[model samples]
Target: MILEVATITLRSGNADEYVRVMPDAFPVLASTPGYIRHELHRGIERPDVFTLFVWWESVEAHNVNFRESDRFPRWRAVWGHLMEGAYVEHFAQVY
Candidate 1:
């Protein structure tokens, strides 16, 4: 399995809007091939900071199946404007 971690920082006063709009993309993401699951976390001390943990069958599954598909743009269109900065990376279980 592959894990995609995305660290996101929201623009000032955009936290509430971000949270509201975030779940809107779940259906799109869930429909993606090879998309296993995902979790969204917010920093306690810094509410504007969030990290999205996504599980996929593989990196290609994430990229080709989701990011390369219409879902990617659908997702970005909803939240891109709210982001102050964001970064994404992939990971694997150590075992």
Candidate 2:
């Protein structure tokens, strides 16, 4: 499986709004092919920062299947406006 980790920074005071709209965006991601599960973590020291973890069957599932699909825009529409920037990376279990 592939783990996609995205560190997202939101516009000031938009954290609450971002969390509120997440449920609405989840469905778009859940419906994608090879999607396994996901989780959202808020920064303790930085309220405007969040980490999103998504599990996919393969790298292509995220890089191509999801990002390249029309669903990308649909997903973005839910909370894209709240985000200032993001850094995303993928990982594989070592053990």
Candidate 3:
């Protein structure tokens, strides 16, 4: 399985609103091929920091199949206003 994590740092005071927006946008991503799961996590110690975990069966499944699809545009619009910046990482489960 391939895991993609996007660490999002909201522009202060917007974190709670940011978290609330995700589930509503999920249907756009969930319908894509090879999308195994989607999860969002917030930092307890750091606060206002979030990690969006996306489980895909393969990189190509995301890069090739999903990105070019129609859903990403609507997905982008969902939280486009609340974001500051994000860092993304692709990882494989080693444990």
Per-residue lDDT over 1-95 for candidate 3, one digit per residue giving the tens place of the 0 to 100 score: 89988898888888888778888889989999999998988999867888899999998878777778887788879986888888888899999
What is candidate 3's CA lDDT for residue 28? 87
TM-score of each: 0.95, 0.98, 0.89
State, as a TM-score between 0 and 1, how close model 2 is to the true structure.
Answer: 0.98
Worst 10 residues of 3 by lDDT: 63-72
When 2 and 3 are scored with lDDT, the better candidate is 2
lDDT against the true structure, each candidate = 0.93, 0.98, 0.86
In order of lDDT, best first, we have: 2, 1, 3
Task: Score residue 33 of candidate 1 by CA lDDT.
Answer: 91
lDDT, residue 72, candidate 1: 95
Q: Which 10-residue span in candidate 2 carries the lowest summed lDDT?
A: 62-71
| Candidate 3 regions with alpha-carbon error over 4 angstroms | none
Q: Could you tally the backbone clashes for each prediction? A: 0, 0, 0
In model 2, pairs of residues that clash are none
By TM-score, rank the candidates, best first: 2, 1, 3
| Per-residue alpha-carbon lDDT of candidate 1 for residues 1-95, written as tens digits (9 for 90 to 100) | 98999999999889889999988978888899999999999889999999999999999999999999999999889889999999999999998
